[model samples]
Target: MTTRFFLTSAATTLLAAIACGPAHAAPDLEAAQAIVDEHSQIPTFEPPGEPFDAKACMADKKLFSVPTSSSIPFVDGIETSMEEVAEEIGFEFQQWKNQAQPTQWVQGMEFAINNGFDGIDLMAGIIPSSLGPQAAAAKAAGIQVFATHWADTTTPDDPAATHSFPIPYTRVGEIIGAWITVKTEGKANVLIIGSDDVPATTPYRKSVQATLDKLCDGGCSHTYVNVPVAEWATKIQTNVQGALIADPTINYIVPIYDSMSQFVLPALTITGKKGQVKIATFNGTPFVIDLVRQGEVEMDIGESLGWIARSTIDAEMRSLCGLDVPEDLYVPLLIFDKDNAETAGVPAGFNQGYGDEHVSGYRKLWGLE
Candidate 1:
């Protein structure tokens, strides 16, 4: 299938995973309004340094990237960045295929270490505990490993495992929850589907729950179901169906990542809950942007995969070259809704952040120009 079609298929098959994977309004309306208002505007990240020598830094270098979910659109974006950057800088960039499970990532690391890849990029879903001995092996083999999104960040600093960036997942949760509160006038029944396998998702889930609990207090209620990423494809629909069936009062279905829309939307259809429940989530993948624009999704708090891809590549490459890395090398998220989807969302087929100058921004930083 074509790459675009493949992403759509994957988006459907993967909704989000082994994984796992809000409210609005009130006198507290001020806070919720602020959350939405702040994100309503586009976010830009300009590097804070002069260009370094890219040719010298990447000369004869090679890297392997292990993505937790190759089928996910966000992962596709990261791979695009790696390939584009690799082509421009003359480095060998190889990515493991269809690594949708945690175990596959561990094995990918072992392959990278054994096969002499110079660096490793840890995409969001690869857990730290799952690394087993591969991390040490990579370090021992003189490989530089940089992580972004959701790799276990608790470890004491390791040179090989150096450099990590942000997505502000907790804030993402808070914003979604607040949006829910505002929309329902602080009285929405929410069914939240999440993945237990993704540890980072824990905080996002908790923050959302906390927001609902705090804002609604006695007025609103939410039921949460956690599944692992490995089983998300098979379990998400059933789990969500069960939650809705058990409590038919559920008026909102919140999938932490917008990609989950693929799975959730169909489940809502099969369960005959389509259009009965509203959706609002994160990642604002291209499809999600369209969903928000078409009014299929109520809100999408989005981080541009295009921006993420570029930011992640710059972080990994710079760390590989021993340049100054920003403490927050993350691309910020923008909030999307019917009012702003037309302008706030990236144009369809334009790549997540194709409008941005991040490539040139990084090039100036690396003296690649």
Candidate 2:
């Protein structure tokens, strides 16, 4: 499947020219605005390939998944939707319950191998390389082992794993950076928060930095802080608060993951900088959308959780059925801001704003309709 890389080098060069100047140099507002406008519209579903008989291929197959953490609402929501899709395709899909621990991930792999499951998916943020021995053992036992929603679109697959359902993390980052540049009108002092443990975060920050460099033209300055996933609840607030206190000029806070907003909101409140510093982030998490609705968060780049589940299942099922797997998960991202945040629902609902085109789209592709 042909996937869209949101920001191209040609586009970047056309945006602005880097010049030696003090921070907050004039940015190319026209270019930044164009980037923001392009992503404002709702995205449509694109089939990864020609339709195939999914039911016939999945007749007796079973899939067992291990998520980074069952405690995370985002991970849980996707896992639940995945099971719903698996049932429609006549495959047994079970999640190996765990609390973001490598030991549990190993155990999940062992269970899948021992029980003769046809496929095992390491879902969302669980690094595959860390479980090399378990992955090798699963492969030896003829179990198809791969990661879903764990890597960026550009990341190389871990040799120990079979394949991946990569997401457009870098694209999401570029959108966030463009949003910041446009809103600040060429002057943006931003704080970027991310987790080092999550492999996808690497590309997310890289793309955001690159976009800022190109569009801001030395007009934007940013500070990056790494807070591991486990420490988000405790560390994010302190880190954000400290940064705000140290640099009162910051106008935006960009969290690579929307869930980090929970901690960020309190930091803004504690520092009395809620309105002073706007927020822009990725992930279409419901709570974050509500923040946008209430005008707390300035913008959020969202990928439908339901859409993600279907795309991931489609790829994994294709692999098990001896069909060609798409190069990347064909899921698309939508920009959510105050103007359209309420469309997701007054209080916001998981995967609610994005139309359900993918629901019917996948049904047709899999011959379920």
Candidate 3:
């Protein structure tokens, strides 16, 4: 495990205090709006490193991926896209379908090791720490285990995986904070919802809380609540309802992950706060982006699945081929709101709107174009 990736006990305590800290008196609206404007544009692809013979490097390599849940559209999309990339690169790719269970993940790892796979990737929301022995066994068998789109770049990488493609989740959190500040003109009252079980959420929440404190100062206020993944269906709506009842002034509900928006939408409708309180979340999941178009969600931070697939493949191939792998996946984030939700698609399409900069850029880097 990289020491830089894990938070110390003191740092964790400090971040907790900051996240729940009291509000200040005024907000720097200008600064908040500046952040919103800067991040709202379509992001371009920047090469993570100099070009290499990715196709050659990937020749005869076998890759398998196990997602947290095959049912999740976001995770499904990325894995499906990865398979497509592997096909184009002329390497064998397989997916181990599972229902977000650690046992299933262990089975997937065992399959990869026994079947002579060159690499295996544990996709979003699947914690590596929970599979320590399985991961160690795979590494022992010379299978390079990877955790992709799981932990944030700021958090320490779990030693279970040989490598990880840390996503910029904290940056997304900060962007959400800025959007909230700008939308409310610096006096926003927010209900911040998250699942503490997801390792990525720690830095994500920390980033949002820190951004709100710096940009809104004491002008903005928020209440934080934890709804673990298993309890989201049963707890999120009621928890949100109770919070709204306690504080009618709350105008924004920010669930760290967009998938949680499903439960939150019901809460808003039940509380008659549908139009009163808006939602903004991470992940460009099509349905959630559709919510943005319908006015149910105010904004969303999007990372195209196709781009993520290419970036993950690029990084993994580099590492496996004994090239220097990037410290993090260079996936670009785009913001979707009422002004631009239609560009993603009238009803929103998976992997649409983010442009093909990655497609062309990666092809060039891989010497495919």
Candidate 4:
């Protein structure tokens, strides 16, 4: 129950007034299209003289697979982007779902390997206790591994050996912290809802904490509320509801992902403080974007858009093709608020796949196309 508030009542009022102004306008399709077109115009980086033979890379008989247990919206995005990449590169693609269970993760890993995958694209936020061994066994089998979201380096072996590219989760935290500071007018009493299952959660939490400590005067004081990893939505709702009942003074709530934030939103509704508390979260799912547009969520750090999946696939392809691979690759973070949620659109693999142009730009970077 470590909660710290930086702004006094007067400061909070002033900040609120500033935020209430017409700070941002509605989404414009033309503007968004222009931005996307600009991004497309940017030249793709080509490896020096095509070091690996693309023909040989595509001829690998084994399957290219992505493994996950659910959680992030971008898992679907990853799969969609991978499918497109596979089509472009002429490789078979497979996907396995663990439904966010530790046991299921092991099962998925075993299943993928048994099914004859030559390479694997691992998602972020799986239970590391299971992941460490699964990754080790996969490596032992000489299967190439690529990772997104959580750094694959957290595996048992030397990180360099386990993952072809490690996405920087800390930088994402910094982006989130900056957005929160602005949205809350430099005064936020943040409650960090976390999961125990994912090893990446620890780093993600710490990075946000560190960023707040550095940016907000009096340091961003927060309470770390532990939520059940399996039933995160229920736990978050229960905890948030209880917290609001006890102290209706909470100014901000930040969850690790949108699915968990679903709980907090209902708690805010029950407390009759729907838009009063500044809600911030990770993973720009459609629900989160709607919350932002409706002025329910103040800001969200969008990790969706399939950047990790594409990166994982690219790394796997590179490794299998014997190309030089980077030790770590960072996926850029987008701060979504009422100003930009509409254009962000539905994530990939939804009823209509293909995320917004902004997300596609990051995807292109990962795929290097």
Best by lDDT: 2
Q: What is the Å distance of residue 20 in model 1 from its true position?
A: 35
Please report the TM-score between candidate 2 and the true structure.
0.92
lDDT value for model 2:
0.88
Cα lDDT, model 2, residue 27? 85
For candidate 4, what is the TM-score? 0.74
Query: What are the per-residue Cα lDDT tens digits for candidate 2 across 1-369?
Result: 998768789777655544433445478888888889988888888898889999998998999999988877678888988988888888899999888778888888999999999999999888888998998899999998888899898998877779877888888888888888888876789899999899999899989988988898977888999998878878999999999999999999998888888899999999999888999998888888998999888888888888988999999989998999988888788899989999999788777888888899999999999
lDDT for 256 in candidate 2 is 87
Most TM-score-accurate candidate: 2
Score each candidate by Cα lDDT: 0.73, 0.88, 0.87, 0.60
The residue ranges of model 2 lying beyond 4 angstroms of the native Cα positions read: 1-25
Encode model 3's per-residue lDDT on 13-55: one tens digit a residue. 9898799786366777788787788877888888998899978
Clashes of each: 27, 2, 5, 1
Better lDDT candidate (1, 3): 3
Tens-place lDDT digits, model 1, residues 1-369: 655534576676566531333223343667777887777765655775546777778887888888778887766766876687778777789988764766778778888888888888777766544574777778777987766776323323333355555457788888888888888877889988887776567788888889877766545688888876666678888888888788888999888777778788777887888878999888767787788888788888877665676667677777787777765446676777888777643454324433466656767776777
My TM-score estimates for the predictions, one after another, are: 0.84, 0.92, 0.90, 0.74
Off by over 4 Å in 4: 1-56, 64-66, 127-137, 152-161, 346-369
